[model samples]
Target: MRSRRGVIEVNTAQIREVADGVPDVCIYELLYNENIEVIEDQCLSKRKCDSAILASDGTVGIFVKPDLPEEYRQFLLWHEYGHFKLHYDENMHFNFYLSRFSWKTEREANTFAALNLLKGEDIYDQNVIALLISKGVPERIAVKTYESLI
Candidate 1:
């Protein structure tokens, strides 16, 4: 799909194929396999952001607050990986301050994370939806995940 920021195209099925059963472990594995560095820095707490910065050296640095819960952290990592997979290049530096681009990019990344993390779940089942909700996933994301699965 083309957006004002740029052309955004992602093969979500391919990403699902790469994500294993466990979301956290799967994201970590994906990052390592892609040679993206995972960095946990408390300094990110000051930035008020939980996003990844793509460095000029082909390293994607994930800035996560120290106090972030495990599940949320996993989601953040996957979201960052989504940016790396869909938008970033070796020469591209992602600046979150670009408001229009940031919104579009963030939506795509959230979709990517939700689809990959919720893959194989029976979204048609109410129990599954409840489980997702219980895990602190936003209802919109859970619904979007169902749409993606279909």
Candidate 2:
């Protein structure tokens, strides 16, 4: 919410600040939660699975897979945090994961993630998707990553 630049984007620094108070963030180094999981392809390619979510208490459980550069991980975590902060308030009755179908909540959560992470501002002119590409972020995550910022 509060950023030094005064522009609100979905950058990792802002994300960390946003999630400063929330608890139980599980960032696995290699393994995934199966249900809620993040993965990083450890071979020749530095590809990472990005993130996952689980329903926990009044909050949504978040998981960030390993293998991303610190900056990218920050984005992924914020995305999950977006799910927690935005989606949790309105749609508590529905369980997102078990539905076996994508819902509007997920899209809203992603939008929150993008707005925070991408924080459209002049300083960071390029969108998150472009930034990720410039930084060599894996293609698999480009879509969601793009959605989050742009």
> Candidate 1's C-alpha lDDT?
0.64
Please name the candidate that would achieve the greatest TM-score relative to the true structure. 1
For residues 13-103, write the lDDT of model 1, one tens digit per residue: 6555544443555677877776777777877767867655556654456666776777777778877777766666654344655655566
- Number of the predicted model whose lDDT against the real structure is largest: 1
Task: Mark the 10 consecutive residues where model 1 has the least summed lDDT.
Answer: 15-24
- What TM-score does candidate 2 reach? 0.45
Error of 2 at 113 (Å): 1.7
Determine which window of 10 residues in candidate 2 has minimal summed lDDT: 25-34
Alpha-carbon runs more than 4 Å astray in model 2? 1-50, 54-61, 89-93, 100-103, 123-128, 132-150
Give candidate 2's whole-model lDDT: 0.48
lDDT of 2 by residue, 69-102 (tens): 7766765655665665544543335555555433
